[model samples]
Target: MKVLVTGGSGFIASWIRKELLARGHSMLVFDHQDRRQQLADGEEFFLGDVRDATAVTEAAAHCDGIIHLAAVLGTQETISNPRPSAETNILGSLNVFEAAAQYNLPTVYAGVGNHAFRLIGTGCYTITKSAAEDLARMYNLYRDGGRITIVRPVNAYGPGQSVAAPYGTSKVRKIAPSFACRALAGAPIEVYGDGTQISDCVYVADVATAFVNALEYTAVHGPTERPVEVGPIESVTVNDIARLVAEQAAILTGREPVAITHLPMRPGEIPNAVVTSDTSTLKQIGLDAIDFVPLDEGIRRTVDYYAQTWLPGYLAA
Candidate 1:
């Protein structure tokens, strides 16, 4: 099968690309970043913005399936400029699905989840991504062109996670990236609030495997009727993640952790954010939960990766 991964250069999307190659499928990575001109060795790269109907149509034209992963769903990125976030996360996703429908490409919506609990907190980012999911489902029902499934993974992190700095309160903290960067820098291992807040984090490799699994199911079963595949990744607490980071850093750098301290939990921090993909629909599509990697091991590997690849520069910063 031919699969197109939008945002294919991103940490998670790249993992999906890797999984596809391992499965012996042809892959076209559809990315808009100027710096991502080169595919990661195996993928056939296509340059396109999900915001462009034409570009999305052109990219969708060439693939048997698509894992739509591109979106600016970060809180700061979204609330900082709601227009672009809405356009990209919502409108951009619409184009991808419409194009998929037009060309009848098998489509899987991978990697979109809410940090904020929609029923409780201010939820611009959640609202937008949720809308995108809804649109894809509707397309599946009415258009009758292709397959549609959504993998709403919560707190996806592992090796190759983002290290970009934050923009606002809405952005919150870069939990995994910031923790790894701080630990490597020998800076205090910071925890916001009591650090008791629990959340689920799916390992990128496991998520990539989930995508591969979903792709296989979709191909065999055809587009899910009332189509959707929901996967709730493994969950952990912020404090536990920090402790694991400190532990791993001590092992990696051959020194004790500099500090483990707390900052006030910022306003709008969800007390506990737990998300599950709609479970009833999973059996309908012939899907089940993928084997989840344990969180401590996942963080250990993530810390080791950032340490080797980005630590020297990150510490310099």
Candidate 2:
């Protein structure tokens, strides 16, 4: 099968591309940026924005399947600039969906469970993403453009994960990378609002595998609009995440254990957020809940990746 992955330069999208290629699928990466990973003989890239209908349609012509992963994410970024977030996350996504409709291409959409649990606190990101989800459903219903399966993932993080850091911005709102970097530098692991807020930190590789499974399921079976929740069976509190990252970084860097500090809760902080998934539903799509990477081990692996690959260049820059 030939696949077109929008936002292919992104961390999770990169992993999806790798997973697809490993399954012997030819790939065409469509993104505004250049490919971060080198393309193999069967892979190619088309540089363009997802908002451009012409560009998206032309790109969609080159593949049999589509994985829509392009979005402007991050609470602070969305809060600071809602217009761009809406334009990209909502309008850009519409372009992709419309192209999928035009081409009658089977598509797998990446969704967020946070959008459904608005009690956790909603922001511009949530609003736009939620709207995008609605558009996906509309396309699935009206267009009859092949199959579209929506998979909502929770707090995806691991090696090669890219936090929401725009070029001219200094704020890093993501928790995992922030904690990992601070720990490696022997800085205190800072938590907000007494560190009680909970998160379902799913491993990136596992999420990638889920995407592959989703693609395959749709390809073999047919279009199904039922949303599939992809996340861990367990949840970890903010304080536990901080402590675990600190401990793992200390071991990897040969540094003293870092202290966990508390700060005022940010505006969009969720008091407690948990993700629940139907394991039987996941199994139908070829995913098993028992395969999720444990939090402690995920943190260790992430710390190692940062220590050996990302941190050195990050600090020097």
Candidate 3:
């Protein structure tokens, strides 16, 4: 299959691209930025934004299916700037769904699992993502749309995740990268609130596999009646994550563990909120064989990546 992957230059999409190529599928990468260095030989690249309906349609024209992953991410980032989040997450998703309907293509919609946790998930990012999921379902039911499988993943983290500002293009502060980068530099690891918020952190590779599996299922069995959720099913507190990153950094750099500090919870964030999901649906899509990377190992790998790739530059800066 020739798949059109929106946000193909992003972290998770990089792993998805590898999975696609390994499975003998070609790619048509559609993103606002050109990270052609990530593209494998013979795969095509289309420079465009998902918010541009015409551009999305043009990219869809040449692909067998679509994997819509582009969006303005970050809870605090989105909360501070809701318009872009709504425009990108909601409007951009609509454009992608419309293009898929036009092309009669099978598509995999990336979603946030916490959007379903009504009480604590009322932030701008969750609301916009929830709206986008609704749009996907509406397109499938009312618009006579093509098969659209929604894969809602919990907190996804891994080696290739970008850091904030001067270090990387991502403006969002993700937990894994934030802690890993700080720890590697022997800087204090900052935890929001009491650091007890429970998160089900799934590795990027596993998340990518789930997307591909869901995509394959849509191609074979048509659209799923409900969104398929993916996660490790195990939970960890925010403080646990910080400590783990510090420990791993110490091992990697032969430095003492950094201090873990607590800050008031950021706006739009819920303190001690447990974000998780029922991942049984993954089994239906043939992902029962996956051995999810444990959190400790995943963090070690993430810290190692930062220690080797970005820490030196970051420390020098």
- Candidate 1 lDDT, 1-317, residue by residue in tens: 88888888777787887888888888888888754555656678788889998988888888888888888756544555678768888888999888888877777785455523655764467768878877877886788784677766667788867675531122335678788878877888778777777755667787787677776777677665643434444455777788888889889999897687998765445655444455455555445555457777788889998889887765565
Distance from true position, residue 10, model 2, in Å? 0.3
Clashing pairs in 2: none
Indicate the residue-level lDDT of 274 in model 3. 83
Q: How well does candidate 1 score on lDDT at residue 69?
A: 89
- Per-model TM-score, in order, reads 0.87, 0.92, 0.95
Candidate 2: tens digits of C-alpha lDDT, residues 110-201: 88867765544667887788888888888777776746888888788888765434311335466788888878877787787787776678
Q: Return the TM-score for candidate 3, rounded to 2 decimals.
A: 0.95
Q: Say which candidate scores most in lDDT.
A: 3
Root-mean-square deviation (CA) per prediction: 3.4, 2.4, 1.7
Most TM-score-accurate candidate: 3
Candidate 3 per-residue C-alpha lDDT over 141-256 given as tens digits, one digit per residue, 9 for 90 to 100 = 88875678899988889988889854566778888888888887778998999988888788899888888888888888888877888887577798888999999999988889
Worst 10 residues of 2 by lDDT: 163-172
TM-score of 1: 0.87
Ranking by TM-score: 3, 2, 1
